[model samples]
Target: MSKSKRLMELMMTVNRMRKFTVRQLADQFDVSPRTILRDLQELSELGVPLYSEVGPHGGYQVLKERILPPIAFSEEEAVAMFFASHALRHYLFLPFEAESSTALQKFYYYMPGDVRDRIDQMKNRVDFLTHTRQQKAEYLGVLLEASVDQRVVTMQYETKNGYSERTIQPVGIYASNGFWYCPAYCFLRRDFRLFRCDRMQSVANDSTGIEPLDHRHIHLGNWEEHGSEKPVYIRMIVDLSREGVRRCESELWHVPHMDITPDGSGQLNQNVPSSELMYFAKFFIGLGNEATVKEPSELVECMKGILNEIMAKYD
Candidate 1:
């Protein structure tokens, strides 16, 4: 093999072997021991974290952090990878925040000059925007690790009722609309619950020897499928004017359940979570006459109560 190919293969081989003698590598690569020793020196200079031990049974071994072998990417693929990491800069916290930054820097540092120039030129033109939030989900790494390992964790959580300690086995963590959420199986609630990551005051491994739920089948994408007994749902039917339909398409959660006509008018007929009726009332109220809630007397009553409070303020 050519010197470059041999070096690359040797890098991968040593990383996989983790510990090997120079003679072993030389024999495997059909190269001289002197050549293998020189290659090892070069790899060490390139930050491969090699450690040598002088004893009959001690061979060289890679340290805790192992360097990955180089992989070739097309120009387009390289740019796409760069922007994928760039888009994440908007988030305040990431599971691998420091590592992500370090990887992106290394990636950019090695790009060809023309590719770097192209990336610089396109930096301002393309962007993936998300809402900016100040609250940091500090335990995202812990939650993610628990999810992957399927281990239970104990955390002090800030709940709507009050602060409470919880033991949960996280299915996964996800980001949406500038917030991080972890859907986990809560031992306290005896069901699956979605916890906002920022609300977690502290997180640690469960030392009580709590048995973790079998959440290997669950993941962020499909945890809702195996969700616990769902909240009460209230049937809601609403008529939307053309303008209302246009607005709802952008902001309404039930847009997919809307029945639209040729004139762009639509009717939303779906069951909404009963706990969110007050929010729905406020939203429909903001729509003024553009929306007409046709059913679910509970929501109508809630809307009336809100309107009454507003009039009382005037009085």
Candidate 2:
């Protein structure tokens, strides 16, 4: 980048931040500390109110009461923003979906007609293939608000057994596997748990105030990252033939235990939750004879039982 462009961005970055270090600036800009020092010197000469403290825990800070002016986007930036906004619209259930849409629309309002035309062309070229939920999660917006305000929420939620009431302190809301899930501190369970937004029947905030969710106390983790969720099924291994591996490449990923030989045959060894046994059974059944069970006689028997049931129906 040219020095002028770098200087403008450097001022904007520093103005937008409360505090930053020379090392942080260097890393962010992919330059050396010496270059950052030179840039800082130039910015200082240009009357940017940058102050520094010399200590083990101290860094540079923008002088108090500074709000930077609005930034103008280049044509490339405007086009990229258009593509980004449309691409993210369908795929993930984001907390800031409404704000994001408004921002995207506002970005186009002041744009040059030529730049808007370029972005329109880019929008036509880009497409994201994703699944849309049949049921709308209207409570997601309310849940997001409650989480931000640190309010306790009382909810009637559907569970495996039946609907149950819960008083929860929502920590984070995330979307995975095509569903929006909120990780919260459940007062009933006295632990962190994930509550599916779609499974929420009714939700309302309690008037009582609580400490807002803090990053220092929050630990976001799930079964894929931790081994603490109880193992629900015996470890099962299934060897796949060459053709089977070819057809199941995408399905085999994210299973946690998978191996493949140079010849293309592979083995998938992982624990399946009993709740998903029928789903996995159907998956293996679809693989036909190309898949062979290798261990955990229970899985083999389960497959045989499913097969027997199918045969009985046919007979």
In order of listing, the candidates' clash counts read 0, 0
Candidate 1, 1-315: lDDT as tens digits: 888888898889988999999899989999899999999999999889999999999889999789999999999999999999999999999999999999999999999999999999999899988778999799999999999998999999997899999999999888877888999998988888889998999999999999887779888777766866867888999999998887777666335488999999999889888998999999899999989999799999999999999999999
The lDDT of each candidate is: 0.90, 0.75
Q: Candidate 2 — which residues are off by over 4 angstroms?
A: 1-69, 72-77, 91-94, 145-151, 160-162, 208-216, 222-279, 286-296
Which pairs of residues clash in candidate 2, taking residues 3 or more apart in a chain or in different chains? none
- Tens-digit per-residue lDDT, 166-198, candidate 2: 988777576654677887777777666778998
Best by lDDT: 1
Candidates in order: C-alpha RMSD to true structure = 3.1, 9.8
Q: Highest TM-score, which number?
A: 1
